[model samples]
Target: MVAQDFIVDLNKPLVFQVGHLGEAYQEWVHQPIVSKEGPRFFESDFWEFLTRTVWWAVPLIWLPVVCWCISMSIRMGHSLPQISLMVVSGIFIWTLLEYTLHRFLFHIETKSYWGNTIHYLLHGCHHKHPMDGLRLVFPPTATAVLCLPFWNLVQLMSTPSITPALFGGGLLGYVIYDVTHYYLHHGQPSSEVPRNLKKYHLNHHFRIQNQGFGITSSLWDKVFGTLPQSKAAKKSR
Candidate 1:
C-alpha cells in the first residue's frame, strides 16, 4: 500500500470572497482570490522532488551550457570575453523579462472586459486558484508561444547562434524564478534566508500594490525604484 504521509484539509474555499469590498469588480471583486489547498508541511511528493531537482540542477547544467558557449565561440572565432559577455547579456535579458512579467502580467487588473478575460487566462486564475499547483509555472505551451516573438526581436540585434545560450540562460532563470515562487508560497524558508519575501508578498495581497515586485531577486525593483519600504525597511532607514 502507498504510504499516506502528511495530510491537511483547510476546508476553506480556495479564493477570496467576492463582493466583500465596497467596489465591485466584475472579475475580481466577487471571485475568490486565494486557494483552498490544504497546507502540507514538508511532505515530499513527485512534484516536490521535481521542483527540488530543478532548483538544484539548473546551476549544474549551466556548466555544460557555458562549455557549449565556449565551443561555439571557438568555432565562430570569438574571444572568451565575448562569450562571457553573451552570458552576462543573457542574464540582463532575463532581468527585463522578470520585471515585465511581474509588473505587467501578474499585476494586471482585470477590471475591463478584455482585461478581465485575459487577466484570468494569464494570472487572475492563479490568484483565484493559487493551490492548483499545475498552473503555477508558465506552461510549456504558453512559453513557446511567448518566446517566438521575443526570439524574433532578439534575432534582429544579434546573430542566430546566440539564441540558444541566451534563451537557455533566460529559461534557466525562469525555472529558478518559478520554483522559488512556488516554494515561497508553500515552502518553509529559514528565518535566516530573509522573511521579507513573505511579508512583501503578503502585503501585495493584504495591503498596497506598489511594493515587492521581486520574485527571484529584487535587483530589478531596486534598480527601477519600485520596492516599498516595509517596517524593516523603515528601521534601516
Candidate 2:
C-alpha cells in the first residue's frame, strides 16, 4: 500500500481503518502525522476520552502516590539517607525500565488482528500521530494497572522496609519520563541537554523507529548499542 498522501479517515472508527491495512498496518502506522487531534478508539465518548492525557496529568495523579510511598518508608523506620538512596535507586531502575519497556513491549511486532489493535492503542498510535500532545503521556488508569506487576517485582527483589521508598522512586522516575517525553514533543528547551533530547526523540519518530528507545537520556541506548547512527551522534563522537 502507498504510504505517502495517505490520510486517516477520522470520521469512521480508527480501529477499523487501521485493521483494513492488514500487513501494511506496520508500515502505515510509522509514517508520522503531526496533529493535536487524537484519533477515536471506542464509540463511547468516555472510553475515547480516556485515551488522551495531558502532560501535567501524570504528576497530578501520581505525585501523591509517590509522596505516600516515601512517607510509608519513613514510618517503617528507614533512615533518611537510606530512603534517599532507595528513592534515587528507584528512579535509576525506572530509567532502565523505561528503555526496556519502550524497546521490547511498545515496539513489539505482531500480525494478528488483536495484537495489532492492542499494539496500536498502546504505542503505534503515538508513532502515527507523533505530535498529538494529548497522547504523549500514558493515561493514569493504564499506569495504575501496570504498577501492580512492577510493585510485586520490587517486593520480590528487596525487603518490605525499603520497598516503599524504592517503588516510590521508580514511580517518580516514570513521572520524570512521562514529563520529559511530553516536553520532548512540545517544550522548547533553552538548554543544551533538553535540546539534544528533543532532537533525539524526534529522530526516533521521524527517522529510525527501532533504535534510540531512551527518552530521559540516551545512556541506555548507547550501552545497548541501539543508538541511532544520526549525524549528530557521529559528530559528537
Q: Tell how far residue 110 is off in model 1, in angstroms.
A: 3.7
**Candidate 1, 169-214: lDDT as tens digits:** 5555666677777666667767955476765665654565546677
Worst 10 residues of 2 by lDDT: 1-10
Tens digit per residue, CA lDDT, model 2, 121-213: 989999988888888999999999999999999999889888989999999999999999999998999999889999999999988899999
lDDT of each: 0.56, 0.88
TM-score of 1: 0.65
What value does the lDDT take at residue 21 in candidate 2?
59
**Highest TM-score: which candidate?**
2
- Best model number under lDDT: 2
